[model samples]
Target chain A: MTTGSPGNNTPLIEARGLHTFYGDSHILHGIDITIHKSETVSLIGRNGMGKTTTLRTLIGLAPPRQGTIKVHGRDIKKSKVHKIVHQGIAYVPDDRGIFPNLSLYENLIMAARSGPNGRDDWPLSRVLDLFPRLKERMGHMGNQLSGGEQQMLTIGRALMTNPDLILLDEATEGLAPKLRKIIWAVIKQIKKAGIATVIVDKDIKTLLEISDRNIIIEKGKIIYDGDSEKLIKEPEILKKYVGV
Target chain B: MEFSFYLIQLLNGIQYGFLLFLVASGLTLVFGIMDVINLAHGSFYMIGAYLAFWLTGIFGSLFLGIVLAIPLAVALGFVVERLAIAYLYKKGHLHQVLLTYALILIFDEAQRFLWGNDSHGVDIPAALSGSITLTDIQVYPVYRLFVSFVCIVIGVGMFYVIQKTKLGMTIRAGASNRQMTQALGINIERLFTIVFSLGVGLAAFAGMIAAPIDSLYPGMGDNILIISLVVVVIGGIGSIKGAFVGAMIIGVSSIFGKTLFPSMASIVVYAMMAGILIWKPQGLFKSA
Candidate 1:
């Protein structure tokens, strides 16, 4: 499962006209977003704009009913969540999803699986290097961790999977300024490691600084798509779409 | 002499509790992981005892009978799970209860149809067919002690699997957050099948081991099924440790209840359940 090196002209993900639902309420309607290898993209939208739905649909959680999704040129619209995960897309859900009963070490180790290349890319040593606080609290249960610590553990666990791509939903919500800085720094390091990332967060300035591209969604539609710098230049687009 | 009588009864209660743990551990896991309220879990117990009787008669060795009965019980567990319990997973609790209750009736009728409506008995192995004198007037059966020791080994093994191993770690994770575990690339549905089957085997093995002391009677499963449910509810749902402690508590209380108040024996465990529920609705040791 050795993938070609990054920047091969082929997009890592290609979602086209994806329509998703939460029971009767239609969420994502024909939304399309493409991501390239090792590149960081951010989904920017107001609350309930289906930013999270796109990520979920990509990972086969709430799979799109009305469109097609391909991961690395392979059709995956109907794959099970575990199969989709095995295809090397690691998702960090908004809830952080730390198993409360597992210790911090267990939480981190349980997600340990080799990437497509079968390399121990993000081992425990690598994770501990990125976030030393996790090292200090290795023996503590997931429930014992603070909100910020839980968030870091979530990101760290995702890395432990050695995935080809990572999707983050509201990764920095409900965190203090200091912790938010750590998250941003981690994002930079993730990019430097040549791992593709799709992030959803509220801080427009940070997203603009860290991401190569920006996508704006509204009412389950990709209303705006462009480079990060271009997205911020159009304050009216942010005002009109995101209600800024 | 009177104190020895009470002491013997106390050990009997503990012995019974261990047997209940055998059945309840499996019941609690299946219910916890799949949320299927399988009322027919104890049918395995009944089948186990019957299998012991038949196999022992065929082989002329009770020990040989116990050995062969293990895999047979596991196969039956797999068959039941694959045939009926698998379908009720998505249904409401009421529907689940109705389906499993229907299964219990089917099992009971099937048992009578196959083995007749009379009680069957098994003999203890020659090695364990002796007794230990506890007092001048009292003696404890060696077979019961052997049963208790086997149960202790299984309980410790179950604990080690759940608490210390990678598979146990996954099970603990799956118990808490099924969706998140799926997202982590674990084949959770497959895990369900194995766990469900493992549970069935435990319940059946309990009956197989206790066959010598407890007669194989029609509707034996029904009474034990209800009691095992009580154990599950009293212990936290899906908790093995809780099941163990809950089994001991119910076992001792019922023994005393039967001796001190014969009329209330049937309902005494339920009375204790009500008190415990009021104190900690989630049971004493909920899986964190």
Candidate 2:
């Protein structure tokens, strides 16, 4: 029976001894972490290192075989993905899973959750203001948006949910350098707005710049978890775990 | 046929197309948002027609019967989703097909168990019972025109709900990616249950409207389910606009096909579906 304010001093999300699988194949093993409020955490690793799997486990898309996931200090491992979301955790997957038939405005509207501010924070106007290009492409379908625009829409969509913690997997994957910079800038803005975030991506240096802390995972286990600065100074440790 | 007769038939085709739109829209929404393939959807329509038949007989007012029948059908839809459909959500599509197929059988048996396997007639209300005179020999049924009008109204209403409203957005998101919609704090399970019920309700409403002209009998929904599936395949999975367009195409083609080449009517519809599949392989409206 986990209970507390989703905000405040309570950790937004905490996973203890999480285990997950794809059929008989085990993907995540005893993964543990806590995302504090207003913190930007990054999960860095090579492909198939269980980064996306961890994110998937949190959302109940691939529910963990064992362990507990507490949202705002409450155990939610048993809850469905939608139920867990009601407790306040937003996830953006690696595939940029936009509804191809729906317009940009429609996509954003779908993720809108009632926030503490009620009508005050992150209205359609504010979202459009943040991604001005989205406003211009408001009527365009999701499939019509450029890759950069799609990335922007995806981030905008997560924010629209007003989640206490936003999980982004492969945030900068398959993007040009310019789009990547814009996304990092957007992440910085999100940090300033005081929303906690977990970003998983391949670009270690850029992610290190945006994320307050980084966790390096190898073969489904957290090999290293520490402040980004520490990992940068000790590139040897990064290479040891990530081989970058 | 005379040129005017062809024009009148064209009007009939449009009218029929519009009705198909009403039914297929709900079908597509259920497929898209809930990600559940409900084989028993046609049963809802059959049930609605039966309800219309009974209620009109009891109340002696077609309008009153239709109005009363809708809520009853929608309530039944809710019950079916809660009792059976919810259990099948995490299961694969194969399981859904099997379970819902079983549901159709169950519903058919139950309907027979209660209503008997006999044909029944429902009368159009007095307000819409008469016909508008076209030519000396040509008269259009007022009820059919009313049916078309009702469909248009419902289509416009559904479009508004799905496009201009907040709930529509959530539904679209749910269809696009079910996992992410839930992660965004949407009560997606409740959303699914609601969507399923609504889909059933729409199918039922179509059945009610159709009862007056087509009459009610056992296995009435069997052909409709197949035809609606054809509409879904033509439109693409999870696209409302696509369903509407597909319904229109199927409706017009079927009407004209029966007139032009009686033996080839059903074949032509299937061929159109095959052609569309070959061209897009994802239907006319693609949802990622």
Candidate 3:
């Protein structure tokens, strides 16, 4: 839980003046963000607008060119991706890079590392409880699972890490509406459990419904940052930035 | 040939196949997990055999020599991984091939410098030197059966470790997705070092056990390395099960090929590899 109320000062993760580049091309430019405890924030933008790039940089996957990334008030600028993960930040990449040949149980067990926070948060049983679908298909290889099941497995794997904050890149990018709703429901449930979430997706309506704040990005910069209700009221801004 | 003769050859083939699995599993894991293509892995096997020969001669105890050879081989494996394989992690595949090739030369020369160029024979332990007669037409070496038993035990133990333990999960995950596994908080460098050494250890152990039956020659490593690669390619790149299955297929096929067409036996293995690759480009079980 945050020591101070929202808009006062305390935030679980804060990204200030973040800049990222892939080779010579600049991807993220001077992006600032503050995510409070137990809040679900959605990053909405069209393709190539640097939504995923920001998440990647924050997670230390693509090292930021210039930025201050603070998790639980600790600076993580020079930290490696695994170190960041050890600090209780879990990232589910867009590709859902599941261990394709490994059985679903193997994938979850492998990713489960006891952080400084301890092992009680996300044990195998807890993870199976979170995603019961994973329990049913525990012996199935990753590639053998359907798209929806893979997505669930990805989320379950992250949860097994006992992460305090979970980053979902394109949470429901290619899922059916029914699956999308299921993912959204799970996200809401995760938020209720006091785990901070930052989800990147194109489903603006669904994202807004679950998110405490919605940040609209254009050309790697936040054009609009405010409460989800305010974001919904501003249809013109949403249409300009997000196609939906 | 008679059915009994065929049966003996079949059993011999299985024996050979299991030995190959022990060597190839480590090679495949090193290749898959660390992405380090070590042409010198076979050199460890050679060193193991030589070490066993010398240690057994000195200690006058075959068990002591075999046990001592394991740690020495592992230490050598660690040195090789640190000195050569570590530097090649981010470099392209071509560099890996060249460096490991160079390593093979260095190891061979070093081996020759210490042990001379003559082929050396290891004495079979008295306890296992006997033979079992299956029929009037045939007899099987008790040592060969012992080798098969050792390989089978190692195989089963490895299977349990890989399937039941946390380390196995990490190994499989690293083999499957290197970057993702690292991102999940695994210190990939440590994992690489451990895996590379473990692989080297297995290859060395295989060599030590096999030395008494097969003479130790300078270029023996080269022959085994090629066969291991063939096993890896046929079984599937990173799949452990693939390595086991491929080794058996190659082992049995080679035995059968020799029986049918003596001169073309080696060619059959390569031909089988080519066919398998053509059918499955990613391999029999491509890791996700």
Candidate 4:
């Protein structure tokens, strides 16, 4: 698949000088990152290094103590989660955040809405088509699904919102190899559909193969941000930072 | 007991149960979705009854009084949720209880200042004032039957909305996971306001409808509050279906206890609650 290149088009999301803390412990220390239209960026880092915090801050789940976050060039540093989402962003948390009380159909249909400026690119039918596995379990409650199916349902639910960008945390954790391939293929399809994505996954090889740009975070700071192809050539950087 | 006597008691029990269901349903949903232990829920019921009594005098019709009173009750609910209950969402249950208990006191004082402490009786609508003769010496008031019928209609409507509508789906989702609901672009704060107001409306509506059958007085909400809490516990904390079943059980059991064992009438409902808890610690239905 052809990847998005750096252009003069306005970026989808931009964060500068993010300083986020959890209670007394400061997690993110002045991290800056940018995502462009139709771009796929992989947020790669070792565990507890602030990849999740970065996504959470960008989505407004974890507000930075001192920073500016802009979506489509509009400042939204203090916006609530729902308001930020209305600007065409969806977040699939690491836990997969499925509502156990709701069935598969309810889960998808509940989030069905046109994107910003009434963009209806991803509908319920389109999402179901993307994951036929989900279509079969429409009547099943969210808790009844296996780990792989829950992940698909979460992704499908996000698409139902018709978002311009999606932040996926731990997209393929604990899934069998076959299920991982299916999830990767779906991610590729999502990229083809021209929706920008920031994926945090443990698979370095898969990340290199699919992402347009790669960013490495070390202790809440952006240590590396460059082309994916170039990052693949530098094994020492991956070993020293990502522990791959 | 004669067949006619048993029949009258049975109808009375069912009617009382229906009224209790209205209050208990709101209590359960509010607790389930918002996680707020509102000790003042019954205050809405008291306000509803007083509103019915006061408005009926002005409107010259019980039906009109109820209709006008509904919106007022809903507005009060909205204001209370925004000004008070909204802050208690993250607070511990102890704080929630303290704040809401304080609200009960405030509402009681407000009621006294506005409507006085005298007991008031609401006249049944002239159209429903007549009674239906079941036997030679047994008769049932049409208004009581009307209350039951209205409750049944509302119950069915509630079931339809909760089971079939998108709003209901979102409500269930909100109850299950509030954070995820927001992540889906849902304005959850708005949804919480709606739920809280609706709960208040339902509780107040129950009070309004029951006013014609039961005498209205200050602190009338206190007894119903305890009873409704029991129903909530019996039905499970957040299950509407459980509330319905639990309310009906208590309603009938209390009526029978009053008739058959007058000395133990008060203890019957408590005993039943104890037995049920011993058997099913989670209540009759699982929390939604």
- TM-score of every prediction relative to native: 0.96, 0.92, 0.93, 0.96
Model 2 clashing residue pairs (backbone): A2-A74, A85-B185
lDDT of each: 0.88, 0.83, 0.86, 0.92
DockQ for all models, in order?
Answer: 0.76, 0.59, 0.58, 0.80
Give residue B130's lDDT in candidate 2 (0 to 100): 96
How is the predicted docking of candidate 2 categorized under the CAPRI scheme? medium
Whole-model lDDT, model 4? 0.92
What level of docking quality does candidate 3 show? medium
TM-score of 4: 0.96
Candidate 3 structure quality by residue, lDDT tens digits, A187-209: 88788778888999877777888
Q: Across residues B78-174, which tens digit of lDDT does each residue of candidate 2 receive?
A: 8988999899888899999999999999989988998998898887777888988888888888988998898989988998988788788778878
How many times do residue backbones clash in model 4? 0
lDDT of 1 by residue, A113-191 (tens): 8876476688899999999989999999999999999999999999988887899999899999999999999989888
Q: Which candidate achieves the best lDDT against the true structure?
A: 4
True contacts kept of each: 0.79, 0.83, 0.77, 0.89
Given candidate 3, what's the lDDT at residue B158? 93
> Model 1, stretches more than 4 Å misplaced?
A1-8
**Model 3: what TM-score?**
0.93
Residue A118 CA displacement from its true place in model 3, Å: 1.5
Candidate numbers, best DockQ first, in rank order: 4, 1, 2, 3
Query: What lDDT is reached at residue B257 by model 4?
Result: 96
Off by over 4 Å in 2: A1-9, A116-120, B263-268, B271-281
